[model samples]
Target: MRNQVVSRDEWLKARVALLEEEKELTRRSDAVALRRQELPWVRIDKAYRFDTDEGAASLGDLFRGRSQLIVYHFMFGPDFTAGCPSCSAIADGFNGFAIHLAHHDVMLWAVSRAPLAKLEAYKRRMGWTFPWASSFGSDFNADFSASITEKQQREGGFEYNYRPAAPLTSRAAAGPVAEYAATTGADAATYMRERPGMSAFALEDGAVYHTYSSYSRGLDGLWGMYQWLDRAPKGRNEQGLWWRRHDEYERA
Candidate 1:
């Protein structure tokens, strides 16, 4: 729907009123970030390993000599022939910021269940320079609640975004789930097994600690396209899945 047309003076008045609410939201967002920083850390005891271009790496090694690490749990399962389009879009934004983050003592990486070769191929295709590591043949994805097993899917035993979810049924074989699954060349069940998330780790006192993690909509802030869309005249204005991998878009 079109906004009501108005004179400049009226528009300025309305915008000024909205500015107050926007300021309040900014303050609240700041407070929430502080709370996130204050969340207690869980010591990581398991020796999680990942396959990277550098070779096999322990979770601590992901920090790459930095004190902090942030890993995007990219939704590319071992069975997937392509990365999730949604994840590809999110990664597209981070690919540029990763170098800045690295310089600021934070190492940013994307971890997926796909094999290293698959990840390398996709990374080349996407032209992403950000570090990507494969959690294939490891429990890292499942332990972190990023990937689930078929048993978990059948038994309704999985939780995503920290909430218990119902077992995957035929219901997932339609709608956006099926649509996204097809894009990755997988069945809905296989696609849904791999979820999108981000996890933060801190290397302190010679040990790695899991400091924070966010999943599902909790990751909205990190999706750069959404941030731009939120400020657009039409806001998100989304209907169903309207995104694709950056390169997949047709030239104007």
Candidate 2:
């Protein structure tokens, strides 16, 4: 990128050095994953329900016959005409891999607060086959820290990513937040009500337990495109929110 040229021996020497650091990071990542799986789980007692294409379904029903479930808290509030473009970008990576995960006993679903009809229409528009369910008229999103009310945003009593997030007014309002809000056909206030996150659940003995939930930047690993970009020569050379839904890419 800097237009610098190096001898083959020098490049090979540098690459081998970097390989050792990469291997060390991989070992550290494996240990952290083990620790995550060892964390305590909480039994879910609330009878949360979701509206899916299959009709009304309970939390247990979301497992769809699998022992494990991973719910992607997509940002699509009740007022939005469409799903969030950024979230849609992430969902683009799901359709293919979700089937393989299902075969391995993990069920994945995208959960949003939007009505089932809206989610269904957008899913069709995006041509994503992965299951999606609506938490409309249910406390599922609120309970999972994926949706907040105007009162909470104004008065301050919510936590995301295991810590209290800064009040809504403090959020940088000029760039992606505003742009994506407009894309969803909702005002900034209404759009900000929905946040992105993912929750993991396990069913054992007919009871579902909350295994894990991640929010904010904690979801970096789940962005499959970013995972690939991080390994590219330029390495995710991002400047602001420069992504869109797959279909929305301009034709050259």
Candidate 3:
């Protein structure tokens, strides 16, 4: 749809009005960030392990001498032939900023349920340099609610994004879910067993503590592309699942 054409003066007046709302949003966001930082930390008692290119590593080892760690719970299941397209898009921006985060005493990593071999291959294909780890055969994904068991799926007893999700049924096998599943060479149920999220951890006094985690829509700010789209003329302007891995786009 087209916006109403207006003279420069009128457009400037409207823009100034909108600017006030934008400023208010910025102020509110700052307050929310402070509140988020004030959330209590939960000490991690379990010893979670992962397989990195460098070899087996514990949750604390992921910090790499840093006091803070951010892990992107990428949706790449054991049976998936490829990573989730949406996750791939989010990760596309990671490689560039990961080093900056590292130098700032924060290590960023992408952790997945897929085997290390598959992750390594896909990383090479995507030309990514960010650190990635495989949580296969580990309870990290399930413990963090990034993956669920078949029993949980069948019984509708799982929680994602801090809320219960509907059980997988034939109806759920259609639409964007099915489309994305097919692209990964799995059914909707198999594909959905793996979910996407981000978790933050803090290392203090020789103990690792989970500081924060966000899922579903909470991850919007982390997706760099969406940040840009929000500023575009048409806004998100999305229709269904229009995104693909960067390499999947056909050049004109």
Candidate 4:
């Protein structure tokens, strides 16, 4: 058997080619980042409010004594009886990341328009202290298109709120229908009729800001990973499928 050896010139030429390609990629990334600075800033209209365990608060209050606030408008709307499983999966992650986010000028908290009691109860059930706030009795959630109002729904916004029946199966998608701005047993019917969430507002020098109400699927990049895995040849990601609700583990 004969072994094939490459010359040093061949190796260096290939390495330099790879280096130039990497440099081109870096240049493109830098150009894209410069555009981020030029993206237009929109001033929020209307007053957004939240009900915290401590009491009623505006968007600024969400800062939790910080300058920048990042609110995860979790899916569990006020009416639904339960929180979203996938979103809860997300909350599971944030339950750990919140500690680190607070270290910076950023305060990351989960926001749902659900009643304060309901939000608190769910937080306990999940064993998460990731700091959730309520937007019950407010239009903040609706304005941001998370939930809908009676007027909006009557005008045909019902499609925007949770529709449990929209799913092809009950067990799989029911959890999502109950998320924020979503209705429960009866609330889903009247979700658009009431203010539901987004209750109050704050005043700055001369403007009113919608205190950071949230939306799901984009808050975390978790949605992107799912989209990519769907195209993967493996069919399923075992690492992401271990959440067995404690029943499957015992059966096995």
Alpha-carbon TM-score of each model against the true structure = 0.97, 0.96, 0.98, 0.59
Which residue pairs clash in candidate 3? none
What C-alpha lDDT do the candidate models reach, one value each?
0.93, 0.91, 0.95, 0.57
| Candidate 1 lDDT over residue span 1-252, tens digit each | 588999999999999999999999999999999999999999999998999999999999999999999999999999999999999989998877899999999999999999999999999999989999999999999888999999989998778888898888797668998988998999899999998999999999889999999998998999998899999999999899988888777941
lDDT of 2 by residue, 75-189 (tens): 9999999999879988988988999999999999999999999999999999999999999999999999999899888877898777886667846555778887998999888
Highest-scoring model, lDDT: 3
Ranking by TM-score: 3, 1, 2, 4
lDDT of 4 by residue, 1-252 (tens): 243467999878887998898899889879975774455444565566888978888777777776555666566665667665445655666766678978966677777777999889877766888788888888766555666554554445243333321312334334433232242333434432322222122335544444433233334343334545555756345643343212224765
Instruction: Give the Å shift of residue 167 in candidate 2.
Output: 2.2
Please list the residue runs of candidate 3 whose C-alpha ends up more than 4 Å from where it truly belongs after superposition.
Answer: none
Worst 10 residues of 3 by lDDT: 243-252
lDDT of 1: 0.93
- For TM-score, candidate 2 versus 3, the one ahead is 3
Root-mean-square deviation (CA) per prediction: 1.3, 1.4, 1.1, 8.3
Give a tens-digit lDDT track for model 3, residues 1-252: 699999999999999999999999999999999998999999999989899999999999999999999999999999999999999999999999999999999999999999999999999999999999999999999999899998888788889999988788888778999999988878899998998999999999899999999999999999999999999999999999999989988851
